[model samples]
Target: MNIVVGITGGIAAYKAVGVIRAFVLLGHDVHVVATDAALRFVGRPTLEAISRNPVHTDLYEGVAQVRHVAIGQAADLIVVAPATASSIAKLAIGLADDLLGTTILASSAPVVVAPAMHTEMWVNAATAANVATLQSRGIRVVGPGTGQLTGSDAGVGRMVEPDEIVAAALAALRPRDLSGRRVLVTAGGTREPIDPVRYIGNRSSGRQGVAIAGAAALRGATVELIGANLEVSPPPGVRLTEVSSAAELAAAAATSAASADIIIMAAAVADYRPEITTQSKIKKETQGDRLRIDLVKNPDILAGLASTRHRGQVIVGFAAETEPDDSALLALGRSKIVRKGADYLVLNRVGWTEGFAVPDNRVLVIDLAGDIVMEASGSKLSVADRILDLLA
Candidate 1:
């Protein structure tokens, strides 16, 4: 695969080197293209040394070979990392003043952007509009996650990690691993209605499951994402089925898994629910000293999927255990994998410090055969890729 790495002006410009290294490690041919401002932060010599190709930073430097058109036409994927607000605006408006912009304009290949800027710039009406415009035209945007910025400010404008950006870029360029493959993935924490306005739910934010669906889609799989009331939106190119209760999730999973080649039970479905839901808000009665609500076990979606899995189909389950001893937790996960008849089980420790609702993650992929293919630690997207690689 021929990958073009486009670097724009931003403090995160240095991170683009990691993205290029990931692709190179994966055995893909890589070339670097930098904007004038990007050069200021990351030297041309450094990029050329890493990419093993001449850095292209000029629109007119190589006019005889029409370098911009040539490079763009040869690219399998165009990734713009540390995509500053300025560059995004330029791309949104079809500007071609430099090599990067001109090459982007000429490329027919899939494009992925990793935006990095201040919180205010990201939330600015112009930037938001530009992002919307780009998405409407089928361009992919990875992240500018919420975290500490260059200075005292802290918000959503921090650039996503290089590994994550690389994963998204690879997903864009690779043969859809799920192409012609039907996959059903459950996402988010299921809500067990207790009353008109309240419900029992877990701490799941659904980021991992959404990443799984997005990764699968990139691999050419037809994905049905059975989502609960998630805080975030599902990635583009997925069929989303919304559900609230555990029962609803189970029903959706069952129906979707009927024709699926792979079924991943990633949702943090509630283990129990109230025996009954009140039509109206329950008042705090002054007459009563205390009150209690009876609870009942909810249907086990993972167990059901495992039990009914077709002969050739693959069923993957997830176990989020909070245990002090990592070895014991892994052992328990292995037992669950066998008991549930799942082909693979992803085990991760969840607590106040790590796992659950966080951008980064660490996981162990234990197969039914008791073999560990990957013991990786990184972003959720990287973890998803490791799982997919094992499946492949």
Candidate 2:
């Protein structure tokens, strides 16, 4: 794959190196098209080193070979990582004053832009209009996610992380095998509330589940994501339902499962919840640090869905265990799959450091016959695609 990465003048331009590096590591032929201002923010040498290609900035430098247009013409995909407001305006109006602009204008490939700017500039009516116009012309906009910007100012207009940008860029080039398929995904760790201020929850950051949802959407699935206190945002094009407790997740999943062709229960649901949830915070002084709250088991959402699923629905369950022995882990996974009666069970060891909040994972897929169907180890996104391959 030939990918042209366009970097604009923005603080987030520094992060574009990660995007370029991700593409290079994915075995794509990467070329950097940086604006002069972008060179100032992120050094040309750095971009060249990461992309494994010389960075192109000047439109006039390549007039003889027609490099400006040729680069874009040869591109399978064009990505603008830190697309500043100024560049967005230029792109909206078809301005080709520089190499980045000319390359974008010359490309027939799918163009993806990850916008970066301050909240004020992003929310401005003119900027919004320009963005809308670009989208109207079929430009794929990744995100200007809400977060910290330059200085203390923060809101919408922060460039999203590099992995997300790379994921979106690559997804555009993948075959949409999941088109028209409805995928139901549950993410994060459900919190069982004991009081208004405190709850019992696992260490799930929702990276794996969120990655699955993102990958599913990228494969052109109509995705419904039920997230229980997710640490990350739902991928672009996914219908998101926010829930905090096991009961809420169960209810949401049950409601959404009927129409889904694939159901993946990835959320680390709490096995028990407080029998009585206090309206006010349970003070340490009043409780003497030894408050014993009665507990009750939450519903087995995966089992229920698997048991009652309509014909042809592929139901997948997840088990995050601390079992250290490999054989024991496989045994546990196999037994759990049989008990839950899910079509497949995904098993992974989650200790303090390896899983839960990490970006990478190692997992085994257990079939109903106690066979290991698939084993994956890599970044969550890659693993997610491997898991989806079963349904795909």
Candidate 3:
């Protein structure tokens, strides 16, 4: 794959080197285009040496071959890591003043930006609006996770890890394993509303589901993500159907799975919901020592989907267990796979060190035939891709 990496001006510009190295290590032919401001942070010689290709920083550097258009048009994927606020705004508005911008303008390949900026800049209405515009056009944004920034301040707007950016870029270029295939993916922990301001939910942060959806889309599948009340944003290009309660998720999953090629029930749906939602907030009363509420079982979305799946369609379910031993955990997954009638099941151990709300994960993919196809221990995206590879 021919990867074109763009580096813009930012304190995080140095991080793009690692991004380039990762792609190169994967045997990708990488070419780099750095903007003038980016050069101030990381010099052209360094990029040239690492990429093993002539680094293009000036739009006029190679006018003989119309280098900007040549580079862009030939790229399999364009990745702009450490994309600064200024660069983001420029790209959003179609600015072509520099090599990076010009190349992007001439390219037909997918463009992915890993943004890095101060919290204030990232949160500004202008930046937010620009990001929305780019996403609406199918441009991919990896991350600006909340963390320590360039300065003493600590908050959102820090760029994601370089390897993550590389993984996302590579995923974009890989064969669409799910192309034309309809996949129904459930995400987030369902929120059972108790009142207007209160709800029953879990600790699920939806990161795993989001990663699955993103990975599925990159494999060329048409994915319908049934998202519960989530704290994080869904990846770009997945069709999202937002729901707040377990009932809503069940309904959505049932409806969407009608035409789906695969159903992945990854959401942490609440087992029970309040029988009756109060019209207003339930206040603490003097006799609250014996307060009680009736609960009802929510619909079983995965079981329901597996029961009526079409011929050849696959059903994948997730099971998060708190078992202490590997044999017990595998046993739990085995039982769930049989009981749920799923074609495959992913067993994840959840606790302070394992799954749930974390970027990395360790999982076992168990099939209905009692075959363990793969045991993954890495980033969620890596696990998701491995699953897709088996399915593909």
Candidate with best lDDT: 2
lDDT string for model 2 (18-116, tens) is 999877754568999998889889999899889889889888887889998999899999999899999999999999999888898888999999999
TM-score of each: 0.63, 0.70, 0.64
> Total clashing residue pairs per candidate?
6, 0, 5
lDDT per prediction?
0.87, 0.91, 0.86
Predicted model with the maximum TM-score? 2
Which digits, one per residue and each the tens of the lDDT, describe model 3 over residues 168-245? Answer: 776766786677888888889999988889898887888788778877887888888988977777876689999988
| Candidate 2 wrong stretches, greater than 4 Å | 1-4, 8-37, 40-168
Residue 103 deviation, candidate 2, in Å? Answer: 12
Whichever of 1 and 3 has more TM-score, that candidate is 3
- How much is the lDDT of residue 45 in candidate 3? 84
Residue clash pairs of candidate 1: 176-219, 176-220, 177-219, 178-220, 178-221, 179-220
Clashes of 1: 6
